[model samples]
Target: MEQISTDVAIIGAGPAGMFAVFECGMLKMSCVLIDALDELGGQCVALYPEKPIYDIPAHPAIEGAALIAQLEQQIAPFGCVKLLGRQVTGLAGEAGNFTLTTSMGDKISAKAVVLAAGAGAFGPNRPPLDGLSAYEASGAVRYYVKRREDLRGKRVVIAGGGDSAVDWALALQGVAAHIAVVHRRPKFRAAPESTAQLDALAAEGKVEMVIPYQLHALHGQDGVLQAVEVVDLDGAPRKLETDVLLPFFGLATELGPIAEWGLDLAQHHVTVTPATMETSISGIFAVGDIASYPGKLKLILQGFAEAAMAAHAIYGLVNPGMALHFEHSTTKGVPG
Candidate 1:
């Protein structure tokens, strides 16, 4: 088994978790960022990279993927160690000293832990259809679209009524040769403007809206899709000949082993001390959406502030009896 050690172990690689690396670096602490997902950015990259977010202070609008890219660039100078595509299954030790074991059998030792797992380990809610996994393996079906060019000139069927399904249909307006959106209801959960745009595309004959339908079966071989079978409310089945299928039902989150780590959880979120962002455990801190407190607003900016506070508290815990004179980033440049 591979073994690694660092001053702090950050348990999530989302925006807040990545920001925690910058905060810890400012305190002259090295961090090892670990996440269950194969890539960083947590919910943003894994769920909806193209979705626009308007509430991230200072920026008028930004996509989920763009925000993650900027955060990754911001922490580049710090050289934060990353351990991705693995789930942390075991946590041992205490304040100023702890060890973590992942599902891949790697062990990490650290002086402190920052649990920035936003909504815990998240995964797309797969549609219930026989042979769905086979199609996913063959690249005929996808839950998340990493690149728009991949779907260019293809017949695509999107399933869902939410932002992902609606926004993607609009995004692929000119990219895909033919795009059809299948939803169980005519109403959508996406923003008004996005829905309006999708409707405009449908009116223009560039997109097809298959309302009140659910996926019945998949026809394909070796994960390659030949067509998709969908059924309407009256059990009327229709087969859509398409090259690709995208099912964006939503995401399902689970705390997994983090729940068994002895931390107090309320509504699947870790309870933390407001002043320090420390969990029930002394050196284990929780921030971002995974951390809960009285009147806590689940915002990116709020988590950023909590990360800074947790980093300061962790610095003291990692280095006992050492006086810390905090200074602004402008005062002290990035450490080499």
Candidate 2:
């Protein structure tokens, strides 16, 4: 097995994990980032890379792929080590000295560990319907719309009441020839503004609102979708003719091996101290969506703040006798 050593071992190369590298580098600490995915960005790059994100602080709106591109540029100067396409299957040892074993039969030794794994090991929640796999294989049913251009001039049926459903409905309005939104209830679980926009589009005859209905069956042959069958409270069937069906039912996520690390767990997340972002086990910290605390917000911005806190706390463990004189970014410029 190949052996590696670092000051901090960051498990997950998402936005938070990438930023953790910068934060640790600024404090003169070397880091090694490990992730199951082959690429840098976690969900952003894998799922919905073209989707627009409106709440990223400075930029009014940015796509998932673009946000990751900017993050890659921001952390380029640090030149941190990356162990992609590998999953950390085992963790052992104590604070200031820990070893992590990966799926690729590699061992990594680090002084501290940071868990920035956003909803570790996630996949879409597909609806339970017969012949679904055929459609999925034929590109008729998809959980994510990687590109809108693929749906151009095609009839699309979007099912769900969440943000993803509403957002995609609005995004593909002009692109798709016909758009129908199917939901079990009239009320949407998405943002009020977005729901209102969807309502406006419905009123304008640009969208069809199939409310109080749930997907019941799929009508197709040989992996080609002919129409979607839905039902209401009374079991009355309604068929929606469409070329494609997008079910934005959200993702099914698991903590995976991180759950067995002996850290305190709440639900599926690691319980951590908000002050330092450290887990119940010393020297092993948790951040991003995997860390749980009082009033925790699952936002990328919040994850960035938590990464900074974890790095500051790890500094103490890496340099036991030394003090971290806090200096603003303006005071100390980044490495060239």
Candidate 3:
């Protein structure tokens, strides 16, 4: 419906996107950051925000939401040129003039494009219990629990055995009325510490651990989830009363359009130069979870480093013959 133009087009608004935005502004390049969330913060908001992240450079440990909020504040002075709550369905052209099409029927042009889409958009693979769809569409069923304070006194049934399930269980321990985790298998993919804690919860009877089972269906009355059908280990069915059915079956995020762009991906992530964070495509670069380089580390701190290099490289492309001085002297990426 409308056309916008800028120096760089950022498709996702996560950690790397935040870093890249500031970097672009420092280089005097205008940017248009498009994402599905109205407020910034990407996966931090999409996933668990209260979870402490230790690997991010200086501070040692900060909650995911806190980090995102801080990043938003840091980029506030830049004044985002354009932030649209829409998906970039398509991309055409290359450096110095890449085009992005939105789901809302809008077109934006940019000098270069950055694919900082981390893990992409993800949700649960299966609904928590049977018939929970009633509350799902009406603003009930959620995959990732971002707001810890909201779950106070609420009964939540989480499904899955991954880090997400384990993390949320711990995060919501005191906040929720009753917490239950049901996975298809007893073995979990979460860290040993997390699993051990869950085991403790199970022993304490604070958490109901349902192993080798799944939520069969949800039963609701008057447009609210009332009961859930759970199949137990011995192929038996049981019903539990639930106000909310939360399926924490990890994120099923798909790279989709980005993958179709053919930017070269190894293990479902964009491949880039470790030092430069530049991808196979000249003007298109990647800097976060969605990107990987020779010795690329997927941590947020590492993403920050990659973002810096990508910014410098982008500046070099925009302004030719400009003496680019890299701040970080140690450079050891897949060289050009």
Candidate 4:
């Protein structure tokens, strides 16, 4: 029942949204940032934080979590209100005066809005596990790992082959008593270094790996997960015991309610007028993992570029009398 307003509203506090906040702060603009996760850094926080980020310029390699920490710390210098562990259930109104409702039942309005909720909403494919919903609570199982401390001394069994799986395998190294990574295929889809590190760890007997298999049954006792049964390659059956199970099969979806906003998605980038991250809705823009221009390169660096450009456009809409931050032709984000 509470209502608030600000100069700008950001739906996500991830990398793209974080960058947008940094710029908005520099511009002395009042803004509110909201995210489904409990903190800043979307993928970095929700999926895998300890994973190294190689594409960021000037920093050859950075852990996703560390990078997010740096971002959070840097943004702290600015006075911005952060709404974590909340989802924006609905958005309505014109460009300058928009209203937002959260799943937590709080409502707010803003002059302009930015949608930078990278691939988090539509989450990991929860392929029918039968009792999945029943066992999901009690922290015995989860789709993502937020804090490393939560994993200390606990045995974990992960299912997937993407970056999240590999990143977590490496992140939970010393903390987890034991880790078993399961994938439906023999080959992994993570970056070379990440996969290489996991491979080395497995070879050194640091972790257990299962290939060409997936979860068939999730067993629990006393209202807590006890173990899991998996079918391996060649239709072999196997069972693994652990305190936790993480299924990170990569972003198992498209846009959430944003798809209802109606934007043309072609090759990851929104079909938009070049240089403008604008979507079908005027004054509304889509950037980062959710958007790409006709030929713009899709990279973390590119997402920042899109976000920066989108900010400028929003600035123009909010205050045409003021100067825009950066030029459209120029790319200026964390140049990777």
| Highest TM-score model number | 2
Kindly indicate the candidate among 3 and 4 with the higher TM-score.
Answer: 3
lDDT per residue (tens digit) for residues 15-127 in model 3: 88988888777666778888877767787766768788877778788998899898887777677765657888999987777888988898998888888888777766865
lDDT of each: 0.91, 0.94, 0.79, 0.77
| Residue-wise C-alpha lDDT for candidate 4, range 15-60, written one tens digit per residue | 8888888766655666788888886888776666756778998889
Of the pair 1 and 2, which is ahead by TM-score? 2
Across 1-336, the per-residue lDDT of candidate 2 in tens digits comes to 569999999999998999999899999899999999999999889987999888789989999999999998888888888999999999999999999999999999999999999878999999999999999999999998889999999999999999999999999978999999999999999999999999999999999999899999999899999999999989999999999999999999998988887889998899999999999999999889999999999998899999999999999999999989989999888856
Candidate 4: pairs in clash: 49-65, 96-111, 269-292, 270-292
Estimated TM-score per prediction?
0.87, 0.98, 0.86, 0.78
Ranking by lDDT: 2, 1, 3, 4
Off by over 4 Å in 2: none
Task: Kindly report which residue stretches of model 1 are placed more than 4 angstroms away from their true locations once superposed.
Answer: 1-5, 47-66, 220-222, 294-299, 322-324
Tell me the TM-score of model 3: 0.86
Top lDDT model: 2
TM-score of 1: 0.87
